[model samples]
Target: MLRSTGSSALNFGEAQGANTDKDYINKASISLKEFKESRVNLKILSKVDYGNASRRVELLDELEQLIRIIATIIKNKK
Candidate 1:
């Protein structure tokens, strides 16, 4: 899950310099999928008693905000 988030951040960083709007949107979409994976993993961790539930929930909230921001970027891309 850490690897997933790290790689997604890297992908998003690369997307920052995309040569075209379409390319940026495509890469951002991939990052969004990866973020979703992390979100699900966090839920699993909570269900299995793997971590502090409160902290995990907080992380989920942060991830949700990030997902929304990325989705909005994709939606408004021209």
Candidate 2:
């Protein structure tokens, strides 16, 4: 999932034209949505199991940060 986001960001950076930038932006947007869904699923899983809760929390935090970064990128691009 992170890989997809990174790939999209890289492609966006390397884009040669406005059309290419829009395409990569859409890809990044989709990746953001998927990441958000994964965050929700992780939250549910954590609620179901107390073991490794701290690690799960850390991951959730990282995912949220990534989401924010991607959102900012998309906003600035538009």
Candidate 3:
């Protein structure tokens, strides 16, 4: 969802300023979760039989790529 997609990025920004390793890791985990949720939303949107399919699919692709990039960041945060 929009909330998750945006929240993930927001959480990541907050994590950057985290004062402890645990805080950083926690926030990154939250971000990763949101990213996954966003992916789910986009996937569901893609399956809808009505509405703007082309535009929805394109947006889904973009969101999926964004989630993937965020996932990479989370995985590399050690």
Candidate 4:
């Protein structure tokens, strides 16, 4: 999950400087999906009593916020 998240983040960085709105939206979409996946994985781990539940919750909150922001950008791009 971490690897996926990191990869998505790198992609997002490239997307941030995209020359076209469509390209930015496309890349941001991928990054957002990856973030959501990470968030869900965090939830599953927490439910299974894996890593620090508190830390997972914190990360979840951050991911949710990021997802919202990215979604807004995609929406506005359209």
Q: Give the per-residue lDDT digits (tens) of candidate 4, residues 33-59.
A: 888888888888888889887888888
lDDT of 3 by residue, 11-30 (tens): 99998999987788889889
Q: TM-score for model 1?
A: 0.95
As for TM-score, the candidate ahead, 3 or 4, is 4
Query: lDDT by residue for model 1 over 32-75, one digit each (tens)?
Result: 99999999988889889897888988999999999999999999
The models' CA-based lDDT, in order, is 0.91, 0.70, 0.81, 0.86
**CA RMSD for every model?**
0.8, 4.1, 1.9, 1.0
lDDT of 2 by residue, 1-78 (tens): 345445545544544344666776776677677667767777777978855888888888988997898789788878
Clashes of 1: 0
**Per-residue error at 41 for model 2, in Å?**
1.1
Clash pairs detected, candidate 3: none
- Supply the TM-score for candidate 4: 0.91
Could you tell me the C-alpha RMSD of candidate 2 in Å?
Answer: 4.1
Pairs that collide, model 4: none
Winner by lDDT between candidate 4 and candidate 2: 4
Off by over 4 Å in 2: 1-19
Question: Looking at candidate 3, what is the lDDT of residue 66?
Answer: 75
Which candidate comes out best when scored by lDDT? 1
